[model samples]
Target: DAGITQSPRYKITETGRQVTLMCHQTWSHSYMFWYRQDLGHGLRLIYYSAAADITDKGEVPDGYVVSRSKTENFPLTLESATRSQTSVYFCASSPVAGTEAFFGQGTRLTVV
Candidate 1:
């Protein structure tokens, strides 16, 4: 099937360590977003790219770095993993703004 996929579905890392979560979509959607799902915050956007090479910070972008050099790939990197960063990260893609978005299974990341 053609859809979005996230690598390392589950990851455990130590504090202060840097980790990168990979996300890829086959649809070549125009909008791709990275969101961290936390208990109280629900789904908070970390970063989003409107198109290849066009990126912007969302609600919570601190300690996170995102790049989209290709329409099919959007990778998010944690500069330094922290205990508070432990959450399920989701990658989503939409053909355009205000449209239905398809999400990946998500990557469960834990920081010790």
Candidate 2:
């Protein structure tokens, strides 16, 4: 069973292109999160949604957006992609915060 999945596991784009990454979970987890992995920052939260259409801004929300119209799906959008935004992105879901979060494989994004 595909517990959680992220689409287009790898991507390459220009500095100004807009890119969207998809995440879907089957568990109907109450909390969904988007995080970016970089060498210096490690894994940092980009955005998170507690429930459908109820999302909160994370540490790095700039140039990124997220929407959760359904409990099982959370999509992360880069309105204006940048080189600094180039990193491995991860989607995670959990029943609640401070608990073990189930994660997707990951989507590697590269902005040239």
Which runs of model 1 end up more than 4 angstroms from their true locations?
Answer: none
* Per-residue C-alpha lDDT of model 1 across residues 7-83, encoded as one tens digit per residue: 98999999999999999999989999999999877999999999999999999999999999999999999999999
Which consecutive 10 residues in model 1 have the weakest lDDT in total? 38-47
lDDT by residue (1-112, candidate 2, tens digit) is 7699999899999988999999999998899999999987789999999989899999989989888989999999998888999899999999877899998999999999
Off-target runs (Cα >4 Å) in candidate 2 are none
Relative to the true structure, candidate 2 has a C-alpha RMSD (angstroms) of 0.9
TM-score of each: 0.97, 0.96
Where is the poorest 10-residue window by lDDT in model 2? 94-103
Highest TM-score against the true fold, candidate? 1
